[model samples]
Target: MAALRKAIQELKQLKEQCVEEQGVEMAALRETNQELQQQKQRCVEEKDKELAALLKENKTLKQEKQRCVEEKDAKTAALQKTNQELKQQKDRCAEEKAVKIAALRERNQELTQLKEHCVKEEAKMAALQTKNQELKQQKSRCVEEKDAEMAALLKENQTLKQEKERCVVEEVKVDKKEDVEVKVEPEVRHDVKMNALEIEQKLLRGNIEELNMKYGKLLKIHEKDKAEMAALRKTNQHLKQLKEPCVEEKDAEMAALQKTNQELKQEKLRFLEVKHFEIVVLHERNHELQQQKERCVEEKDAEIVASHERNQELEQQKERCVEEKDAEIVALHERNQELEQQKERCVEEKDAEIVALHERNQELEQQKERCVEEKDAEIVASHERNQELEQQKERCVEEKDAEIVALHERNQELEQQKERCVEEKDAEIVALHERNQELEQQKERCVEEKDAEIVALHERNLELEQQKERCVEEKDAEIVALHERNQELEQQKERCVEEKDAEIVALHERNQELEQQKERCVEEKDAEIAALLKKQLKKPPKALCVVKEELVEVKVELEVEQEVRVDQPEQTNEPIPTTQRRTTPRWRRVINSFYCIRPNVNDD
Candidate 1:
């Protein structure tokens, strides 16, 4: 009985210790459960914060994308407007160029007509000068003949005076001889001398009449020469008037040509100015476009950086959440290990207590013969209490197992959520990379287009330069041709002046020759009159009259011959046809080449 009591006391002490241990374990389990719940709440809050941040970043990205798109659209519109303006400017320039070209063509045609008129006028002037030269020659010859006749008449008068003096001397001699011969045959000799003297006087009067007629003819010829000189002077005045008008017209045409040239130069300068302005505008536009592109690139880079930063932030948050969850999971695992260890210790304690109870039961059975019934009743009640405590422990273990299963399911769900978040982040990163690639491709395309445009502009500039060079060359050729024409005109004027001077010198020389001829003819006529007077002294008075009439007829014949010579120049001065075949074709070719060149330049 004492042993039973001792065993019962020990059992009571062991039960008390086990109950205290169970209570401590229950407190630890409750604390762990509370800590797990708090950790789960913190994880849920962090997840919520992260989700909110992600949503905000996504919204910001969308807004930035929309803004970028709007900016791009605006830039494109501006570029289109600039292009349209450039096209309009180009069209205006083309129209202006065409107008200028047409005007130049008309000017060229007018110049060509003026050139033709000038050539015709020059040819007419040359013909008129030749005719005037021929007329001058005829007039000079007529004047020469008149001078010779005048000299002859003067010589004849001198011969007649000498003849009268000789006749007076002969009459005195005849008187002296007749006084001496009067005794021989006075009546017959006196009658013969008187009759002979009378006949000689009559012949002298006839010669005087012939000389008067020749003087009258010479006076008439002199009058005609003066009239011819007056006509030649009038013709010269008319030619001078005509030449003055022609010179004035030439000057006007030259001034017009110069004006046209000035206008062309002004137009060229204006065109150059316009081209320069266009180039400057193009450069400005290019600069603006480049600036806009740079700004866009900067914006895109900023957006990309922001996205990268945001992604990094999300990744960091995810890492932090994962770390935190891992820590929580590790803590839960540690708590579970600790709970399992406590449960095993509790089970070991229960097993040791059961073994002790079995030993005690054996000892009690051996000692039961000496024990009382009250002790048995007490032992049965204690055993029932132990069984109830074991049942409660089992219930607690089942509840802990259920809690562990729930925690395991929650951790699995969190893992799935973390995996889904990782997948979503990866997908978003991939999308961002694709968007970046597309943007880069678009930039490349734009750059290529710009390069192509620049190349085209360069080619256009080259073509314009070539056209400008060709135009300069044409202008130079035209200038050279104009200079050559001016030189030719100057040379022609010099030639005409020289010809006029030579004609004047020739006229003076002919006048001198005619004066000499007139002096010689006067001497010869005096000699002939002296011989005729001597012959008449031996011949009949009727024969002397016949000789006088024949001399008059010869003078008339000479005058008629001079008139026939003067009319001969008219037949040689027939109008000649002008040939402009070479100049016409050359001008036509030049115009055709210009037309061809213009179209080719425009095409380029």
Candidate 2:
């Protein structure tokens, strides 16, 4: 019994030690689970922060894309407006060129007709001069013939006077001889001499009247020829005065035409230069747009790759958390099995002890019956020995009674010990039941916590999925928008290319027109220069003096026109600065300088 008690005490101590050990293991498992939960919570927080940062970055990128799109749209709009304005300017230039060409053609025709008319007038003037010369020679010849006839008449008159003197002297001598003969012959001879003298005096008087009439007629014819020559000289002067003004007006018209041609040529060249500049600007803009597109695409690809990597990391974390949870659940299941096995062994040991105690109680009852029978036999013998052995028998009975009392006391102690042991077993069973209830509660709590954690993990997974879906949707939307923008850009590029081609064609046409204009201007300038030289050569001194003043005025006008052309470039909204203009090609600069200098020289 002592050994059994010792064994039972040892078993109780072992059970207490196992219970303490299980409690410590449960504490350690709880601590580890709490730490795992804390770590998972921290991981979730970090993932959330990363997701938030990624979202913020994505939003910023989208906003930048929108801003870029708006800026591109504004630039495209501005380019379109500029293109329209340029097209309008080109149209206006074309109209102006056409109008100028028509005016030039009309002016050329007028100049040609004027030249023909001038030629005819000059021929007519030459013919009239020749006719005037013929008239003057015929008048001189008439005067010479009249002078010779007058000389002949004067000589004859002198001879007639001498003959008249001789006749008078002969008449006096005849009168003296007749007077002497009359005295002798009587009255008939004196009457015949008187009749002959009277007839001679009447014939001399008629000849004197004819000579006076002839001298008066010759003086009247000389006065009439002098008056006719003076009238012809006046008419020739009037015709020359009338032709001078017409020739001067023709020359002025030619000069104006030449100036207009030069202006047109300059304008064409300016337009061509402006077109080339616009083309260069457009090409630069296109290149910049392409570079911007490439940069945007690269940035988007980088962002997508980063997001994908982040998602992969999150998935790995979730897998690690699940693995940890599975390991914890497996450990908990193993701990429950160990606790159940210990409880079963304790119950089996208690049953074996109860069977051994029952067998010992049956053997003690048989020994007590045999001891009662021997005591009865000993009482019989003491009676047989009678009174002489009474004292010794009495003493022996007392000893037996003492032994029975000791055995009862011992039985009472054994019963007390068994009662104590049963009480201890009941207490231990109650403690085990309490421990099992605690463990069950703990397991239920652990299961509930696990369920809650699972719920939280499921909710987190759903949230992550939703976030991924939203990110994908946003990315898809962005891609669609970028595709649309790319298409618009492509269309814009094609349109710009077409516009450039059109502009190039137009420029080529304008260049051809400018070349033709230049040729025409050169021709017109040559014609004007020839006309000026001819006028200088052919004009009378008084006409040349008038022309020099008019030429100076024309040159001044040409200079003013050239200055206006130079000022025209300044009228542009963004004119090239003087420094930039000075950097122009040498040939262009030389051409401009020549034009400017020529007019000044002509003015001088």
Candidate 3:
């Protein structure tokens, strides 16, 4: 720029010098013109032949002077134009120089700022480096601490595991000891008692195993939760790296961070894999426990049967003992009867013994009546106890039914969450499809702008590409998620249906049980009614026998009175028995144990 400015100044000086030289040349030409005019005047004065030649020469000289002036003017105008262009070029150059200077100054400022920034950055980097080093040291220390803690925790876990195992073993041993003790008591009994003992042992074993499996599952879940937390931290770090750029450094740092992120993602995947394995293990344990529970239930059922048999045996033994006692009482009664017969023969001459025996019989009948009343009270109490037991069983069934309803509700919530997930997936797929359509439209417009003749073709190609991408993305996504959702809903529906089926089965079972209970109650009522009818029949026959006895006693009294009247006929002629007949008793009293009725005997 300075060079150009100096060049322009030199050119301007040269132009000024040329103008001065042209002015001097023009002054000399003017002087020559005046001398020529004077020469012309002289030529006229001379009036000779040299005068025409002088005039021709003078005119030619005048033409040459005009040509010189025109040439000078053309050169001056050319110079002026050149000067203008140069001035413009100089101005442009000056502007360019100013721009360059500004740029240079800016660059210098930038360089200085950059240098300062570099220093600051260097300090920052040093600080960061120190921090990084500190972080590295801290990380190392953290790693060391974590490793130590992990080792310690692992050792503690191992010790806890060992203790758990020992506890499990001790529990098993104690369970076995309890089982043995339970067995020993039953072994002494040897029949149903042993069965009961074995059932209890099996139940205990099943419960123990179930508890152990649950504990193991809980432990595994705890471990999985810890692992999941670690994995989440790793994933969080990875995601942070992916989302944020390393603005402090270049692309290399970006690449490194990406690599680290990939590593972290891989680690997360590994953790997921471990979790899956743990889940599988837990499932297996659950399956084993379920099987154990099933076996225990079966054993319990067998024990119930055994207990029922033992109860029957005990009842039979009680009945046998009662029968034996009854037989002894009967034999004692026969011995008392023989003594009574001997006493009767001895008392044939003394009537007082007979009266005493009659009174004793009346006391014995009263005692029998008291015993029958006590038996009836016992029977009524047994019936009440049975009713209470039935009510309790019904309440238990109702509770189980409520639990089933809750389970069904939970299942419905799970189904709804699954549906929501499916819908979200579908929405995501639809958004992707819309994006694909938009991309295709953009592509079609781009193609249309490029080539009109091939616009349709380009559009078609774009459409096809978009369609293909959508097809692949949407079809795969839609098929997988839709199919999965469909399958899930199907499975859920099936599960719901299965649960309904189970509920139906339970309902059916309950209905069947209720039907059976109703049948039993009906049978019991029928039996009770039959017993009441039998007692009614027996009471009527006894009442008829008592009526017949009363009638016979009245008939005997009439006959004895008639014979006495016959023997005293002459002494009491005035009261001589008239043949007037007395009317028969009109009403008979019926005693029916729980009810008494009077029957009119007018027809009789």
Best by lDDT: 1
What's the C-alpha lDDT at position 321 in model 3? Answer: 56
State the lDDT of candidate 2 residue by residue for 411-477, as single tens digits.
4654465466457657856865786676568557666767876898899999999999999999999
Q: What's the TM-score of every candidate structure? A: 0.35, 0.32, 0.18
Assess the local accuracy of residue 172 in candidate 3 as a C-alpha lDDT between 0 and 100. Answer: 74
- Which rank order by lDDT, best down to worst? 1, 2, 3
Task: Tell me which of candidates 2 and 3 scores higher on lDDT.
Answer: 2
Expressed as tens digits, the lDDT of each residue in 475-521 for candidate 3 is 89978999999999999999999998977676666556656755775
Ranking by TM-score: 1, 2, 3
C-alpha displacement of 352 in model 1, angstroms? 99
| Model 3: CA > 4 A from native | 1-47, 107-126, 142-604
lDDT of 1 by residue, 375-476 (tens): 335435534644554465346446544644554464465446546645765787898788667656855765675576568779999999999999999999
Native-referenced Cα lDDT, model 3: 0.54
Q: What do the candidate models score in CA lDDT, each in turn?
A: 0.61, 0.59, 0.54
